[model samples]
Target: MIIPAIDLIKGEVVRLHQGKFNLKRKYLYEPLFYIQKCLKEGAKKIHIVDLDGAKNPNKKQINLLKEISKYQIPSIQIGGGIRSQKDIDLIFDLIPNAQIILGSSIIKDFKNVQKWFNLYNPHSIILALDIKFNKNYEKIIFINGWQNKSNMIFEDIIEKFLNIGLKYVLCTDISRDGTFLGPNINLYTEIVKKYPEIFFQASGGISTLQDILNLKNSGVKNIIIGRAFLEKKFTIKEANLCWQKE
Candidate 1:
């Protein structure tokens, strides 16, 4: 699946280079315009992240989300700063069909996250594992808008979640995010082969059709494309065709 991504800061569409706020790039279009365009281009799912919320849980883009919900888009995955039951409830109320993406909260409050999985359908929540490689070449998870690092291991985190009936995961390589270089193929390929039961959504640095094909060949069933689509590397229809091609 070619899921288009829209990152919002102050209700404006933007992209951050390698997860750094200092290297942000704002786009010209509004969130609704981008959503409508993606839908028109055959995108069945859209990934939205609230940068403000991720940086500070208190500052979630509620008004913007409310406006977006008016479209009644069913397959939107809303993430960033969703840390509690209240946040979850508010998002569901705004966009009833949205899948809540849990990032920092998953690490900070694993027990609550477990409860959420039991409360809501496992598929309704996506565990976002934004990771970076250390000097020792270890994959470490980063949280709190990628500003802080957690000592959690990649496989260890997934193993814990899998026991709780985790069905969806969106993993991004922070080093490659917004870089337009390419995805972490080696990392994704290894993880996909190891955990074939979970639906893994590969994100970050997907800039070309070949990148999509490479991931597909490596057993990745879904990918999140942001800058690639925005920069016109390829259209949604073209990416879908590539993914659907035999």
Candidate 2:
């Protein structure tokens, strides 16, 4: 699946390079424009990130999210700044069947999140592991919009949670994110091979159709394309065609 991204920064459409807020390009359009564009051109799933909300959990992008959910076009997955059931309720109030992505909460209180976050269908809740490969050559999970790094390893965290009903996860290579170079194919290959049961979505650094094919051939069933799509490297129609070929 090619999940198009519509990142909201200050309630406007924007994309950040390498997850750096200081380095970003804001597009001239309301969030709904892009959300509808993706749906109009053939997008099965859309990923929306709340930049401001991620930084300040108290400030919810409720208005923006509510507008996007009103379309009811396809699966709408939202993340960033969502940390509690209260936030989830506010989101569901807008779109009852929406999917929620859990970020720092996985690191802040893994056990509590795992146990308390059992109110929905396992597939609707996803763990977004925003990770960075540290200089020590270990993949460490980053939280708070990639501002804080943790000592916990990515594999260990997943292994620990898989038993507690972690059915879905999206992994983003922070260094390659928004660069449009390509994804860390080897990393995803190892992950898919190790835990074939978990539904993993490979995100970040996807620029071309070959990159999509490579990841698909490597056993990655879902791919998240952000900058590449926004930059018009390929249209949603073309990606949807490719997915049909699969």
Among the numbered candidates, top TM-score falls to: 1
Q: Candidate 1: where are CA atoms >4 Å away?
A: none
Residue-by-residue lDDT tens digits, candidate 2, 1-246? 888988887788888889999999988778888878898998988888898888778876777777777687668888988888788778777877778888988888776677655666677788999889878878899988888888789998888888767888899999899898788999899988999998889988989988888888778778888888888999988987886676
Total clashes, candidate 1?
A: 0
* List of clashing residue pairs for candidate 2: none
C-alpha lDDT of all candidate models, in order: 0.92, 0.84
lDDT of 1: 0.92
Off by over 4 Å in 2: none
Clashes found in each candidate (C-alpha, N, C closer than 3 A)? 0, 0
- Evaluate residue 218 in candidate 1 and report its C-alpha lDDT on the 0 to 100 scale: 80
Overlapping backbone residue pairs in candidate 2 total 0
- Cα lDDT tens digits for candidate 1, 37-102: 999999999999999999999999999998988895649999999999999999988877889999
